[model samples]
Target: MLEKYASFCYDQIGSYILDSLDYFEDIRPHLSKANIQVSLPEYVSAMVLSSMFVSITTLTVLGSILMIGSGIAGLIYGMILSLISGTLTLVGFYIYPSIIIKSRASKIRDTLPFATMYLSTLAGTGTSLPKLFKVLSEVDEYGEVAKEAERISRDIETFNMDTNEALKNAAERTPSEDFKNLMWGMNHTLTSGGSLRSFLRERSDTLMNDYRRRVEEFSETLSLLVEMYITVVIVGSIIFTSMSLVMTTFSPNMSTGFIVRLQVLSIFIGLPMISGMFIVLVGGLAPGGIR
Candidate 1:
């Protein structure tokens, strides 16, 4: 449905949209890296159309509700909110490709060590390059790396691209720097008549070592984050709430309601926010492939 809408939007006014944009050219490479199937004009048009739809919906719903309760002032506030929502939606759409690229890169990095090990094993058996990739592509255990292998295989089989040409294209578009380097290395090794098996085996060892180091680093970081969460969120909140309660008992000038509100804020709002932040921190620090 969205694809159809995007296509229609592009067909109607794509040239005008493309002409008005300065950054769409810059975004083209990101689309390729992110593996987004849509053309640049289609994506931009979808973004515009989606943002417009959301803004209009927000305005109609919220503005009606507000106008019923607060008249013209409510309508004005609703309009402002709709505009903000529309702008944020547009910005989110614009940056979505970069987000996908980053995620794909992370997934590729996570799977690369194991994938390369498998590649090295296949190369040791004297399997042809095309057959090696085709086999890897069929294996779902490699995650994003498998998808990448599938693309390479497709290029060779379907697009009629030679190994070097396909590898060059894959290296250019791959989101992970490590994967890009690996592809380039493979291309060079093959072209120079070097031992592909030896190169892959060496690369596999290096990647495994790096992966181990990352996991170790994440273990240390996780311990620190655990300690911080305990001290700042749990123990600190208990102390703060207790102290506030005792203070309200002694100080008649301090409103009991205000003290209660503070306790509520600390226990309900602050605790959750701090805990959520710690969770996010731990997730970010944890190595991608440990599981």
Candidate 2:
């Protein structure tokens, strides 16, 4: 359904969308690195169409509700909110490819050391480059590395590209700098009649060491995060609730209902929101495949 809508949007005004955006060409590499299958014009069209749809829907629903409640002032506020939402939606679509590229790079980096070790083993067995990638592509354990391998394998087998040419293309498009270097290294080794097995073994060792360092760094980060969680969410909530209860008890003029609502909001809403935010922060900071 989304594809059909995007296609329809593209067919209607894709040329105008493409011509209006000076940075459309600049995002091509990002799209390639992120492995987004849509063309630049189609993507821009989809962004424009989606933003318009969301803006119109928000305006109709929220404006009607607000208009009924607060007259013209509420309607004006609703329009402002709709505009903000539409702008944010447009910005989100614009940056989505970069986010995907970063995520893919992280996943690839996390899995590369083990995948390189596996490739070293295969290389030692005198397996050809295409065959090595084909085997890697079939292994689900490697995650994004496996998917990247599948692309390389497809380039060699299905596209009839030679190993060097395929590696070059992969290096050009890959989000991970380490993976790109590996491809280039392998290409050079093959061209120079050097030993593929030895090169891979050395590269694998380097990557493993880097991976261990990253894991140790994350361990330190995790400890700090745990301390923050306890301090800010647990202890802070308890202290705030205690203070609120004491104030309510001492101050006879304050509304008991208001105090009770404050306590409820702190416990039910604030604590959960803080905890959820912490969880998202930790997840984003942690290396891929660990959490």
lDDT of 2 by residue, 239-288 (tens): 98889889988998999899889888988898899889999999988877
Clashing pairs in 2: none
lDDT, candidate 2, at 47: 90
Clashes of 1: 0
> Considering only N, C-alpha and C atoms within 3 Å, which residue pairs clash in candidate 1?
none
lDDT of each: 0.90, 0.91
Could you give candidate 1's per-residue lDDT for residues 1-291 as a string of tens digits? Answer: 656877987887787787756766788899889988778889898888778889999999999999998999999989998999999999998899999999999989888999999999999999999999999999998988998999999999999999999999999999999999999999999999999999999999999999998898888888888888889977887788789978988999999999888888877888888888877877776767754
Question: What TM-score does each of the candidates earn?
Answer: 0.86, 0.87
- Point out the worst 10-residue segment of candidate 2 by lDDT: 18-27
Compute the lDDT of residue 132 as modeled in candidate 2.
99
TM-score of 2: 0.87
